[model samples]
Target: MEPDTLFVVGLALGVLSIPAVVSSVSRGERPRIATITLMIAGTMLVWAISNKPGGYSIEAIPAMVKRVLQGFT
Candidate 1:
């Protein structure tokens, strides 16, 4: 898929998931830490998706890969 297409897909999914996030937190159905983490992650994903930096761009890939590697080590 194209960058724009992927971005739209990510943005749509992120926005659509917002309601579930609220419901999950409100009902105390999931752990607080997990819910909070999801919100934070979703927020970042939404920003990346909506902005013009573009999906999976060269600049983004390095930073993202760095973060992932850092997380595991």
Candidate 2:
């Protein structure tokens, strides 16, 4: 997959995991799954950023997300 796509996926996964982490904590659980999800997401995002030419910029994210979504439809 493209670096931008990977970055967007990882970012989305990381964002989604926040609710899981919060729910687990509220329920007095260990949040194991959420923790793992966060770790993997972080790894993917970091890898994508490091591998991409010129690095990543916040300004390019919307276009990147649009391009990725277009591929799936």
TM-scores, in order shown?
0.44, 0.93
How displaced is residue 38 in candidate 2, in Å? 0.5
Best by lDDT: 2
> Candidate 2 on 14-66: residue-level lDDT in tens?
99999999999999999999999999999999999999999978888888888
Clashing pairs in 1: none
lDDT of 2: 0.93
TM-score of 1: 0.44
lDDT of 2 at 12: 95
Residues 1-73, model 1: lDDT tens digits? 3334344445455566677778877897864555555566566666656664534665665565555546557
TM-score of 2: 0.93
lDDT of 1: 0.57
**lDDT score of residue 7 within candidate 1:** 43
